[model samples]
Target: MPLHPACECHTATRSYEFSESHAIRGSTIGMVLSKQAIPDISQNGGKHADFPGAKAPYVSKMKFLNEQSYDPIPIYRVIDNKGQVIDRTEEPRIDNETLLNMYKTMVQLNQMDEILIESQQQGRISMYLTNYGEEGIQVGSGAALLPRDMIFAQYRELGVLLYRGMTVTEIVNQCYGNHEDRDKGRQIPMHFGNKEKNIVTASSPLATQMPQAVGAAYAFKRAPNNERCVICYFGDGAASEGDAHAAFNFAATLQCPVILFCRNNGYAVWTPTNQQYRGDGIAARGLALGLHTIRVDGTDALAVYRAVERAREIAIQNKPVLIESMSYRVGLHSTADFSNNAFRSVEEIQKWAQEENPVEKLRLYLEGKGLWNSDIEKQFAKEARDIVLRTIQEADQKKKAHWKEMLKDVYYVMPQHLQKQMNQMEKHLEKYKEHYPLDQFQSE
Candidate 1:
């Protein structure tokens, strides 16, 4: 509250005159010193205070006071369906190897999802979720990130983990819940994680990772030396959760480097996106919360790569970003979703498959660039399926974890209550020796 040393004004009138004459109108000094409101231009038919420059026509603030809708957020795209660069000059100049890797990863993901989903249906695994139509967001956005960037992914973002160097065998072991599983068989299939890779364990509860991602980004901000960002992936349905709002607000207010990628895949399982919200989906919420927001076509890997690279560049400067990727859940949401075709029309799915297929789109683009061919693709498809089948078979040979394994990792030392429960279970199992599989409880 200290005044300038040479200031002579001590009276309210002198202060008012000084503020009115020299201070910036609505600027810091004028806002603090003056109480006079700007004249309403609607009454005098002159220039509006809010509108500094005269325009042909302007909507007064009160004119649409009752209106709630805002202008639509524009969609950004770098590539088109016909293997064309629509963004021409602005298109990202990704190297051939990197572009080929993106295409390869999408193919691997497509094959992996198909095999695993079939395995689940055959009851080889308890459950599985497929990223059938959303490989671009996982692969493209993931390819754009640095190695040290923390990634908290939804179940379908297997490509992100793959990009981060998680091996096929490791993922299959996690799916099988074998001895090689990172969580020691504690987590179910698809909830993969590895601290070494900075990929947080995925959760089943919707949007739970949002606040966690925000918290991690805040920690990164505090460290200052990490120079890393937290990129969290969730679906449009997950964005409807309360944690999402809290996470967005905190990230924006704290100016944390959190890149939130919401794959608006047109459904929360079976519930259509239209049934979830009336607003302009998740991107509008991000803008409303002061985060830099963009909506991009999810099927285009090049577009996703460019968009995420830009978002990452901004996030490193301590600004949060929200990317709502418009896609479709063209495959079963989960293995248990046997009635998927009943809830959604087959004709719509066929259209999406024929036109906006993520893997096929990238393949076409790669083929157009002379980076791929029908013969190579055919050979690669066979190799991809073989790798998955071999890995799954190897993981299956490891056998499921014993019941004793589940009670091992919960604490530094086993608590007395848990120990007591284990003792009681051991006694009960001994009494029913012939009623169950003998090796099921036995740790081998």
Candidate 2:
């Protein structure tokens, strides 16, 4: 009867778990069905019965918030652009004087960049790199470092060096490639290396310092010093390199005490950030790799300082921390790209120069606080200019290095063929001594 009861299944059956968690709160039954079953969830399938009039207008709809909700990562800040603290949880911890100092370091770094770049243009120096929009990142983080801690800087970190009390003369000497340079004039301009300051010498290769930084941090951990850690600085463009990923993995594996600061300035040379990756920000990538990470407004010195302070604490606890300072590179990547008419528009540059420039914001903060008046500002500018000019003049007055520099430093003794080459160079210098008169140069 009824086509044999054992063989018959008359009804269509659909099976799924019907827990309260499976029910979406704000969606209608039909809408939920349309979304769950359909490849393309749309009202075109006669689903927009709620308002038939909505069909004619063709308002494209986004999916209802079931699983995908936009949760913004918390942004940490200590001081506003006006140099006032808005957060009361750590009210007495951060004071105005500390902020002023941070502001001053930012100014000094910006000023130094301006001077060095201009010096390069004037043919007074061979080369220089500027941290045009990134002074706050380096100086603020550097302020959190202990005196004995190691700093592995990218070439454009004179601000951090200055904060550590690197004298103007030392900077000039390094730039000038003189005997007074701690590297013995081995490296080029902005390739800073000072044992006294505990800053590693910068190299020309991108992301080359990443591993070295990790090694330094590992050493610190093994040695187990309370005051020892390694703070490494690099750009967002550098993060795309393999060395960066390797360094992160190595540091995470070892729990090395390293603070990796990435100034995500939207460009690596000429490439923009949109082309870099589809994922979230660089700080998120750091977090994904099991590092304590933070992203902060790089233009805000106080926020950067506080984040760095926290990062320092984490680092001391044998955690590798990554900090991505969101900033804009307002100037050309270097002095070599002088054309304002190329790649980027002048209007874009001017907009940032007026509003987003770190130096401009710091000046505004200083003025707002009544900490710096017009007269003092003018005096500061004049003094900075004079100091830069004198430093350049002194560096230029230093004697040029001899060809023996090429043969030295890397070996305890020269090989026979190398010695022959050195002899040839010495002969060439002797023959040209009249033209480059040794007596005309200052004593090393």
Candidate 3:
């Protein structure tokens, strides 16, 4: 139950000294840990980091210095809540299209989520997950990566697929599990992937993508002159999975080009983030593994992009980076999860809706810069809604997967045993013509 033995934060007063000559370039910007004997805290509990601008400015540093070796990772912020640029240096150098696209993507994500959620409720679609208040983390991080860099996603990464030009038709069809669905109705709603875009198939299992990303990145290194890294996404809850920790350690040890992006929205399902872990959030785990790590404001798209852009650079060189984006969800975890009905309050969700909507936060910045207007906003919303409706209409016409698909991809050549079983099924269906619908399995 203790932290990793190599977790320097487990000690007091981390004994680290900088060696400029041996340093990894472009890193070591702040608090580079060097190997040395740490001094005893011999003070108050000594289980926390002592940063310069810690929450307690009044308390003396020595009084709180504990056995904890790592400091709280500083949050990198560029924009404020009112959409003002607080740090000019950290601003991402993006063109107008890039800037406008960020706003457009967020709006589209919201619109699509709304329509799909309605469909799920109406029984038209099986399930859906809303980006809600965390659209910035979804769209921003997606824009930061190149087409070749792979994304191993958690379920909530619809923004990433939408940004990469996944159409409403494709998304709707997948959710509808119709004939046009890419996976041939194999996966449930929201678990989509594009082979051409280099995105991995999203599975429902928690924390599985992190380790997969590392292995994929390792394989990428062996490819012919391939210059790419893997970006894996998971939630605060998935970070608790043992696979996540194992992936972190392997990533650091193997020196793979992978960025483990953790969306620390402060909850893993119904459990509040406070109950998730005792140490610093997901970012600290990356530091404990000695990987270059960063914490950023998830509500600020530019900040998330900046962190990921730099992380991509480091990852391309076969160095892993972990990013923790602090944000909150306005809606429940998913269509099946009714956290508000049981554990959360309506007022709490409403509070985030008004104060922390990432889409609105980015919209405010764009409007303030004279890049957006109410007219444009209305157009964005209206067009997104129309497209989703049209997609749904077309998807409804498509039929389900054919019978051949049942046994098709399981093997290059249908094994004799499976072939025999299929033949027997066909005969049985023929015998029960009234009950069995052979045409449904035959073809669309």
Candidate 4:
């Protein structure tokens, strides 16, 4: 049966048939079965074995399936690189307001990345990561989700937080680790979490959110008339982790309603996709794991929105889906790493940034629709920059979280040992107050 309209399962099936023919050609048992067969077992209403573990047809010949047995999964795309819709039928029926908001959010996200990355370079922030070329995947998927939907994001999905109503000030505060920050200056820059926004705090470890998101989905499944689903976002690099495989198996076996969204942005730090895995992209792994799978062109905003919208529909029906969004990381992995030094070329990054940029693609679409122009673009660009700069200024001026905040949140009640430690630190600070930057931190 056909799956999504953009899916090319037929091609996969045809490739598998061709490979199987070659695989069984030299086997004598296969040759004998071709010429002779036992009495039909279908007369008893069962042609395949009904084993406790699997229900599969019994083959007369031995065969092994490999990666080459199927064609690479086709990427689902609604628009071309020029931002023209490839299929009108496939275009999502998003309203002008929603479409405009998505475009604006992507633009804002791009602007934020530019400013924040520069801020890190200027020593304003300790570290940062940019969404860069993958803005469409973030905003498009964010637009498709409900406000109530829980999001488990890897560190790079700042656009999703912005779309989900996290304020610019809130983001800047987190980056600055100011007194107003929700995490009490505990996390690194870009590790955003808002309980009210339903986005879990991002951790530095790869793929840890996968199993946790599945556990949340299982809880939602057991709830009475559960209407919400969990969306777990990770990178292609994270998919290689054992936790990722565990999450996939448990989600498939327990039938959790979760969307395992993988951003295959060509590299995990300095390692490229070719070195990451030998098989087809991450979508192939999803297929083997028995999840509803789709590969999407992450640069096309419309395509991402349509793919995620459908994925959400399937997910809320108690089916887990995996979407591998393919794009390029036009920026460095983070402020800590430098690209174009060894692994990839600057020209290659420039090519993708110019021709396949998600922000520019959506801008072209909006321009074609008469919803955007050079004037609007300039105005919005200035406004976005002003807002980010203003937020950063305000956040930087704010006092840092109190020195004692580091020890306060670890326990519901301060233990005796912790209290003694806190007292010792307080006494040490009081004795050496002139040596430390006490004015920068909040007072006791």
Candidate 5:
């Protein structure tokens, strides 16, 4: 029987395809296009000085007489588990050495995370967040970016900063909370910031960095600088924040070159994905928001690198891309969490450690290619330990900063009110001089 032209039925022209089992690995849409069909400049609620002119390039010609309603969009990706390259077109043009470097960084990050957490437990630092499981997401994305292009990150992105040439000594100094710390001892340990690297200091507040990243990317797109894009890193938990949504709308509307990288590690602190949203993956959320999205196995370095490589290309072309890297948080959310917390079972952590270890995955890949062996692991561990221990030892010996540093860097010059406050505080301290000798306590 002939089916009606508009019928939802297949006839002689139907296509047949066989599918094999495939494992699926897995931020923002602007509000203007959804609400007004035409952009409402006033709908841009906050300070977007850099966004000038048409905000939505994809729908600049649309006309509407009513308030527009935009759909919640989900994101997209290219890589999968088992280290397979499923998207040939988006495959990165990288060498084996580059691949090896990515794996090495992942291993280094794992060791660093473990070492830092131990350091915190031993009273060496005030706080720490482990980048243990999300190593590939940061390392691969960081490697794909230009050195000069600014990167804004959340608290758990030491791998990215390290890949961008941050020294272990500097990391140790910051961890030690000494005056020599590049952040001037202003933040908690593992809180990253480097003006010279053009990497903005990470604030403890969640999601704030996302919008700033949008602004930075917008500047790069509008400025005379030769740089192409900016990459911002956040966690799946951050995806629920208002700032993340706001940043996406701003970036999409302005056609800013930015990549929103979300590490969907299955939990946000004590809350699991089942508790956060009904969606199966964050990529679908990004797609609903009208973003070009990608989902990949976050535990696979090659997959992450390839996805990020293509993301960078799209960002450079003045379009935004959002990547959701699906992985696990093998460690506690931070050093502060009780190891025995019921948020996750010990058995779950053990299961992931045995199977989803990204370092082990890459090591297996390397060994399969005959490029890795016991000697490589031994040498890498020895060097990493030696270097890390030396840096920490030196940092521990450095002088600490005075409380006055709390007021420093907050202004170009001390305002009159601050000057007066500083003087008053000094006077209050002078009264205690006879009770406690300053010379005896001065850090050297």
Candidate 6:
């Protein structure tokens, strides 16, 4: 609120009040201007050297600010690691049905991740990224938003999609690249998108969705009485991308209604936060860029829900907000990342997995409220696992999209070049019909 409280720059001018007592104390006249003086001077057209870029009062001190000047931004948390609400007033007033749904969604996401990761190892899918310890950040924030609000996600936010009503079958179909997939078997596994759900398709390049989300938010801002806002999710690694800087600056300056959600899960692949950056974290960057910012404990679903609920309200008023959800990545970055050679030790992973697991934390909270028990947990776990397994089996049996389908979607009216290419492919496939597994693919 006071800018950088420890930094003796612009914040120093706004924080102090001008008084006769200060003059009596021989305080520098440059540092004596009160917060009320700025507006009064401006209204009277006083000869203050007002810079077009900055409106801060001139300060007497010549001091340079560094990372150590301010303390790290405190993370907001409604519940502790034991899943007990630290403050009753801070706890969100979620309905029992919604709470159960959120808990179940997170469990389902975890179950899906387990089977899918194993499936990847068994060569059932090409690749997979697990949600692991960040399920609360996904499901909690997802539940706080309106379904109509747009979402632009990085690879690891499957729980958000699940919470937004994406069926397990739809997800498995995409993973298997079956004919029923919304992308028509075009995209790689885990790069999910659904137009009906308002979630943009994930791309492999880091932070590519940031600017796109801001553009969409700008469009929503222009719409009269627009209630919708865009939520763009990325990992801490993605936050280091150049596109992230552009997106933040544009969102702040243009007053776009967007939430830049950063899952600061302790590592950018193998690199830890210490190696990633020197400053406080992604939230500090948002503050410097003029965006409303907050840091939340990613493992606490209730805290995440409360933070995002308030963020959405601010965003709808054309104020962009940045939320840094802090947690640890308890799993390997992806199936490609071998655990034995992982940068983090097994013990560290296990510690976070057991102590700060988002799903387990929510389960404890439910148990405390008399809303859950071992019986319910066992039943839901089995049901979730069965659903994922059944969906995977069905998806495996389904045929791949027709080979010709790929070239068809590129253009509404096929051009001569593409048409010739398609014809050539067809002729080649026909000649080698016996060599190719035609039974595994849909017929033309």
Q: Which number leads on lDDT?
A: 6
Question: Model 3 off-target regions past 4 Å?
Answer: 1-71, 436-444
In candidate 2, which residue ranges exceed 4 Å CA deviation? Answer: 1-74, 82-84, 90-97, 338-341, 366-370, 431-444
lDDT of 6 by residue, 324-391 (tens): 99999888888888663457778888889898988888999999999999998999899999999999
- The predicted structure with the larger lDDT, 1 or 4, is 4
What is residue 11's positional error in candidate 5, in angstroms? 31
TM-score of each: 0.86, 0.79, 0.83, 0.89, 0.79, 0.89
Instruction: TM-score winner between 2 and 3, please give it.
Output: 3
In model 2, where is the ten-residue run with the lowest total lDDT?
1-10
Cα lDDT tens digits for candidate 3, 147-232 = 98898998999999888888878888899887678888878899989999888999999999889999998898777368888999
Report the error of model 5 at residue 364, Å. Answer: 1.6
TM-score of 1: 0.86
Give the least accurate 10-residue stretch of model 3, judged by summed lDDT.
Answer: 1-10
Error of 6 at 261 (Å): 0.3
Q: CA lDDT, every prediction?
A: 0.83, 0.74, 0.83, 0.87, 0.74, 0.89
Q: Write the per-residue lDDT of candidate 1 for residues 189-269, one digit (tens) a residue.
A: 999899999999999999999999999999999899677999999998898899999999999999999999999999998
User: Candidate 6 at 384: error in angstroms?
Assistant: 0.9
Model 4 C-alpha lDDT per residue in residues 1-444, reported as the tens digit of each score:
222121222211111122333444565331223212222222223435434566576677998988798888999998888888888889899999999999989888888998998889899899999888999999999999999889999999998999999989999999999999999888999888888889999999999999999999999999847688999999999999999999999999889989999999999999999999998889988888899999999998888899888998898888999999999998889989865557888789899999998988888888888999999989988999999999998988999989999998889999999999999998998899999998999886
What are the root-mean-square deviations of the candidates from the true structure over C-alphas? 7.1, 12.7, 10.5, 10.0, 13.9, 8.9
> Worst 10-residue stretch by lDDT in candidate 1?
5-14
Pick the winner on lDDT between candidates 4 and 5: 4
Scanning candidate 6 in windows of ten residues, the lowest lDDT window is 39-48
Give candidate 4 regions above 4 Å deviation. 1-47
Flag regions of model 6 displaced more than 4 Å.
1-49
